[model samples]
Target: MELIVDATPTATVIRVMATRIDAPTALQFKEDMRAITAGFDGRIILDLANVEFIDSSGLGAVVASMKQLRPDQSLELAALQPIVEKVFRLTRMDTIFAIHASADHACAAGNT
Candidate 1:
């Protein structure tokens, strides 16, 4: 699993390059998110376009990452693969966090 973080003026985008965000890669994903948001106050957009699968731990890690962000900051998610989207909906988290169809949409949310 590879986690690449990119920051925009309005949001920090974290892209996960992995087939699955399961137990094995969840911890690293959480840590990478922490490191990326350490000194930033902008909104967060986690891009999951490359993630094909996600397990319970993986879902938990994503939630944990959101919680880890500074209280002043906000967290959003974008570009979720179909299977992963199903998980979020099934877990009823689709309503908990802002979900966007694309990164552009996510970023635009902060703009307006």
Candidate 2:
């Protein structure tokens, strides 16, 4: 699980460099997210533009990531592929987190 971290004035954008976030990479994805988001105190946007697939474990990992965040910090998602977006929608996880069209759009929305 290769996650690229980009810090902006408003949020930290972590881009999923891998194409899939399934059972095999789920643990590593959560671990990496913990390490990368350790000190961040603002909103964190996960850019999933490159991710084409996400299984149940992957979805669990994403939810776990949000659970591990500080109370003041938040985890949002952006640029999800249609398939991935469907998973979130079908699972009703879409209502749990704020989903943006893109990382830039999330950033533009500010801390709201």
Whole-model Cα lDDT per candidate? 0.87, 0.96
In model 2, the runs with Cα more than 4 Å from the true position are none
**How much is the lDDT of residue 39 in candidate 2?**
69
Identify the candidate with maximal TM-score: 2
> Of the candidates shown, which would achieve the greatest lDDT relative to the real structure?
2
TM-score computed on alpha carbons, candidate 1: 0.93
Among all windows of 10 consecutive residues in model 2, the one with the lowest summed lDDT is 103-112
The TM-score, computed over Cα atoms with residue i paired to residue i, of candidate 2 is 0.97
* lDDT: worst 10-residue window of model 1: 1-10
Off by over 4 Å in 1: none
lDDT, candidate 2, equals 0.96
Which pairs of residues have clashing backbones in candidate 2? Answer: none
